[model samples]
Structures are given as structure tokens and as C-alpha cells.
Target: MAEEMKRMIALGFEGSANKIGVGVVTLDGTILSNPRHTYITPPGQGFLPRETAQHHLQHVLPLVKEALKTARVTPDDLDCLCYTKGPGMGAPLQVAAIVVRVLSQLWKKPIVAVNHCVAHIEMGRIVTGAIDPVVLYVSGGNTQVIAYSEGKYRIFGETIDIAVGNCLDRFARVLTLSNDPSPGYNIEQVAKKGEKFIDLPYVVKGMDVSFSGILSFIEATAEEKLKNNECTPADLCYSLQETLFAMLVEITERAMAHCDKRDVLIVGGVGCNEQLQEMMRIMCSERGGNLYATDDRYCIDNGAMIAYTGLLAFAHGTTTPLEESIFTQRFRTDEVHAIWREKEATEKKAN
Candidate 1:
């Protein structure tokens, strides 16, 4: 089994968002080489969707080449081409999909387009070995509680508007936090120095959650307080972290209640937030549930997750034909067929 898996080289492309990452991963989750790199739109350059896509188009090939070189692997050595399918900008996804298609033909390998969100969740599962945990995916574009159900992964709960990470990033931008550094990281830094807690709206809907109201409230409060020089940026940052993480923890605990799950796994970029993880740990422990998280290698946006998921899909024979090869802007989590152990079984039978 190990030998067979080694024979497969999964080259993953992640252009679903601002980051354009390419990695080469094997079946056992061993990232043979993932040359880390990122593409950033210039500061004060507000979100230009098409321009972002164009930036991805410009960098995709160079990044992939650098990754393959770093991995010391040739094009013919690769067995599959994988890319982030959706839940991101259409233009950037198209760039990745087109590249994958061209590479599939060049290398005569299978192409797999995977759900970006599901890829993040699967990365957590692979890294943490959380067999049946309820997933809390918090990122710039998404925030949701997901569980595998029926033949598809279902969204137990999610944000009604902007994602938690997006909320944080917007707030950070407003506060002139580090633009070069990741927002979540910078927010975590500022959060530690905060001395006082400020109240923010806590909006929860059954199992679902919303951050827009809370974000607006915080922004307004920050603006009003700034006029009086009432609070330091660090204080506001810490207070914001506490409030937002508490909301996330509340929602996750509620979902666990409905699911009766004993394992909780967090994923995506926001998973790196220490405050969020700490709150989730406390909440899960209070509920007699275990909490797991992926390390930095798997947490932030990367191509490794795409390659890993694509390898699973390919091994399970859930393939796509060229005619049907197109990216969706909003692919749902439930759209994918979960085949973890089943994939191993089929691979065994094939041999």
C-alpha cells in the first residue's frame, strides 16, 4: 500500500483566494515539497476581483515550477493534478482549473478539482486523526460547522454574512494593523496586550452564526471611542478577540450538542488564532469532547490540502471528465463524497 501510494505524486494548486500556493504531496499526507509563497494585492488597492485573478494567472506557473524544482520532481514523475474547485473567486479558480487541465494533458495524468473548504477540513482530519469530529472551518471566505452525513458532508451551521476571518481582516485594516503579515496572526499579537474587555453583539441562530452585526458594532464602538482616546488599539484588539472567539465557541458548542459529537476539529486560516483555539478547547472540554487542530503547515492556505484531497478522490475513482471540468464559485461542502477508508479498500481491491 505504501509503495503504491509512493508511486502517486499529487501536485496541488491553490488559487482559490488571495494566496496562490502550489505543493507536491504523496498519498500518506507526506508533503514531499511545498515551496511556500503568496501573492498580495498592493496596499490600498481595494478588492479587484478580476485583477486578483490576473495576478494568479501570472504567478501560477512560476510558483508550480519553483515547487516542483524544490521537490526535485519532474513533470512526468507526477501522477495527478489537483486544484481548488470553488468557494472562491471565479476568475482565480478558472486560472487554476485551466492550468490543471493543461497539466493533465501534458503529463497524461488524472485531474481532480476539489472543494477548498472540504480540503481544509480533510487536512485537519489527516493531521489530527480526528475520526468523527465536528468541523469548525473559519477562514476569510467561510465559517461553518460541518459533519459527514449520508453520501455527502453537510453544513451543520455557518455564517449568514462575511466570514469570521474576513471580519477580523476588515477590522485590522481599519485599525492599520500589519498588512504584510496575515491578519489573524497580527490580531493574535495585538490581542495579548489588550487589558480591558469590550462588549460586542453575540448573534446566534439555532446552530447557525453571524458576524456582520458584531463586526459593525465593534467598528462603530472603536470609532466612537477613538474620538475620546478612550481605549488603546491593543485593548480593542483583545476585546474583539474575546468577543468573537466566544461567539465561535458558543456556536461550536451548540452544534456539538445537536450532533452529540465527542470530537471537535478546527481548520482554515482562522484556526491559527490562539484565542479561538483556547476558547474552543475550554468549550469542548466542558462538553466532555476532545479538540484537535492542524499545525501551521496545514492550517493556512496551501496546495497540500488540495493535493491530499485530490489523491483521495482519485484513489476512490470519483474522477471528472474533461467535458465536465469547470470550477464553481460556491461549491457546497455537501457536494463531495467522503471516501476515507473506502478509498483504501477500493485501492486494495484494484491491486
Candidate 2:
């Protein structure tokens, strides 16, 4: 009874890729502190696993301490520890799991393993107050259109090859753009000046999308076109964004229609783009639906989402054993059994 009366808190660690984030969250979805550091490579380059893992190790502990300090909570105040378990870079995922394992042993708190995709959706729902929304998750490593069904956030559609963010990042590199904040962000900023839209390859097969062909085509011809003054960087950026976001909106709307849902939730880092959000909003509005999104804080990979999802799972009797606390790089979103949403799914289906 006394333990039940106490406010349950979770300390979460997310080092699934270039970003290393630590956050303190309560069971009621209140975020006390979320601090993170991103490992940015030089322009025209992408971060590799070894370097990214080292970066996570260098900053994770300090960030954890800072999160605790800012949240005004100690290890004793936390009820559990959580971390991103899969669907990320292997070495980077291991960094968070290793840290959480040590913390669990020291603090004598239970551990909860969270799926990264599920965390994104859960965080968007909590922040935007969106319920039963068809989600479009676009990030550096993943791109998927998802909806809840049969107690899982099922993937209705996804990228067949490289993700949309990767395509945008590669295009930014071709333009020799800065990666200070993000490649996608730089592309968005430059795209604002674009007037004429040069036609690019638009590939959409059913509910899935493919960007490798477009990226290869752009990589081969962008510089030549720029040198010949055939197309400006802004025009290229604008065309690429329009083509890709249209494919995304198409598939997301398809999923929404298939699920009979009226709300759209955009998650992951690439969802932070205003252009993408606007396109999705227009599509949702045409369908008499609402579009939901968040800023960089919750949209990018962060520990707050992991903490909140793990807290929800923990409250619903989910726990991770020490031996089973392992990292998987290819875990799919549908692989997770969302015990917390079982009742909701059943009721929704019944209705």
C-alpha cells in the first residue's frame, strides 16, 4: 500500500544512434528532465557504428547525472530503469543497455526494455493528446506507416530501401551543406527559397516507398546540374522534399483509411520538418482528420519517450530479466507485444 502510494518514477537511457539522451519521467507522463548530445560528422559524411558508440560512452554518464540533477531526483526516488532495446545501431544500443544494467544492479530497481518505434508513438500521443492515430514514423534509420491492431502497433507500410532522412542527408551532402543541427534541417531552410520545382523520380508501389533510385539519380546529376546552372540547390531540395513527402502522405492516408482512423500522428526526427507536417496536415484535413506532431524535443530520438513507454509497460506488469536484457538492431515495431494497449485494442475493435 505504501509503495502504491508513492509516485513511480523512471530513469531512461536512449543511445540507439548518434544521439545519447537521458531523461527522468514519472508514471503519469510528466517529464522532469531530458538532456542529450548528438554525434555529428563532417559535412559529406555519415556517422559509423564505432565512432557513434564511442561518442555515446563519452557523454552518457554525464548526461545521466545532469538529468537527475535537473529532475531533482536521486536513484532512490526512481522505481525503475528503462532503455531503448532494439531497431537501432547495434553498438549504440549496447551502450544504453550496459548502462541500464549497471544502474539496475546498483539501485536495485526493475528494468524495462522499450521498443524505439513504440516509444516515439507513445510520446507523441502523450504530448499531443492524440488517441488511436495512424502514425507515420520517419527517421534516419526507419520509415514506416503504422496503426494499432491486435494489441500491436502494426507496420502498415515502410521504406523498401534507404530511409527518407538518409536520402535527404545524402542530398544535403551533395550540396556541401552544414550538419551542425541536422542535414534535413539545413535542406528545409534552403528549400524555402525554391520557386521552380524540377521533377524527380517519384516511386510509390502500393503502400511502400523506395528512395534509393531517386538518391542515386540525384547523387549522379545534382553537381552537374548545379555547375551547368540548370537547377539551384534550393530547387533541388524543394523538389526532393516534395516528391518524398508526397509518397509519405499517400501511404499514411492509405493506412488511415484502412484502419478507419481520423487522426494522424507523425513521429521520429524527420517528422520535425514543417513542410512534411504541413503536407500531412493538408492530407488529413482533406479526409476530415486531425494531424498531430511534436517539435525536436519529442520528435527526435530522446530518452523521455523511452522512459514514458517503459513506465507504461512497467505499470502493466512488463519486466525484463537480466539474462534477457539484450539488444537487437533489426527488431520490427510489430514484434513488440503491447500489453498496455491490449484492452484498448480489444474495445476499439469491438466498437
Give the per-residue Cα lDDT of candidate 2 at 258: 87
Q: Write the per-residue lDDT of candidate 2 for residues 154-239, one digit (tens) a residue.
A: 99999999999999998898888988899999999999998889878899999999999999887777868888999889988888
lDDT by residue (1-351, candidate 1, tens digit) is 769866677899998877788988887778877755555544423355788788888888888989899888998888788888898988878888999888888788888879898899878888898877899999989999887765567898899999998988888877877656576678789889889787778888887778889888888988999789888788888988887788778778877888889779999999988778888898888878889997677898898899988988887676778767798888888777777655544666799
The Cα RMSD in angstroms, rounded to one decimal, for candidate 1 relative to the true structure is 2.7
Model 1: residues >4 Å from true position, as ranges? 41-46, 341-351
lDDT of each: 0.82, 0.92
**How does model 2 fare in lDDT?**
0.92
Which has the greatest TM-score?
2
